[model samples]
Target: MEDISIISMLLTAVFVLGCLYLVIIPFFKDETFLDHTRKSHTNGATKEALLTTLNEIEFEYKMEKLSESDYRQLKKQYESQVAKLMRDEETSTEKAIDRDLLAEVEREIEASIQQKSKKGGGK
Candidate 1:
């Protein structure tokens, strides 16, 4: 009876440990796989979604479903988000334009140098 009880207690401990390992292992593993599968929405898609949400909020407020203060607060938050998105889009556009201009300038400089070299070599 003593030996059986000891064996049973050891088995219970092992089972508990196994359960804990199953629960705790995820916390220790790399979470990049989750990120890899979860792609973020593009700026256009996100802007459209926000606009739709804003329209819905306006309709709800008109229907008297939301309090005036709540409507104002929500409107402010969504408007800020939209503004930030617009700013990000504009910044990205400006950076692209800058890069194109720089590339054009570099090409022009290279062409001028090559032309001078050819003229000097011929002389």
Candidate 2:
């Protein structure tokens, strides 16, 4: 009975240590993970003023403030955001082009009808 009690105590200690490790490791890991993910999701930029945050990143990179791996990783992230921004910009411009074409077609049809009416009235 004493041997069984000692074994149970050791098992309980091991289980408690394992639980503590499981809880602590994840809390530390989450900080870095969340920061990287937040930097990745910045693909949304506005138009009309053209803001690019890459230069500041480069400056930090050149100053040796950031590690090589981090600089490369962050540069890649900014490039992706820029690509997404450009795609959205292109989409907006294409929509605008389509709108102008539609307006021009409407104006041309109205002009033709006006000319036809004038000719009929004159006759």
Q: Report how far residue 106 has shifted in candidate 1, in Å.
A: 0.3
Each candidate's lDDT (Cα)?
0.92, 0.78
For model 2, what is the error of residue 79's alpha carbon versus the real structure, in angstroms, after optimal superposition?
Answer: 1.5
TM-score of each: 0.61, 0.50
- Which of the numbered candidates is closest to the native, going by highest lDDT? 1
RMSD of 2: 15.6
lDDT of 1 by residue, 35-66 (tens): 54453346678999999999999999999999
Pairs that collide, model 2: none
Residue 89 error for model 2, in Å?
Answer: 2.3
Ten-residue stretch with the least lDDT total in model 2: 42-51
Which of the numbered candidates is closest to the native, going by highest TM-score?
1
- Looking at candidate 1, the ten consecutive residues that score lowest on lDDT are 34-43
Report the lDDT tens digits of candidate 2 across residue range 5-112. Answer: 999999999999999999889776658777756644543423222234567667888998989898788879877766777887689779999999999999999999
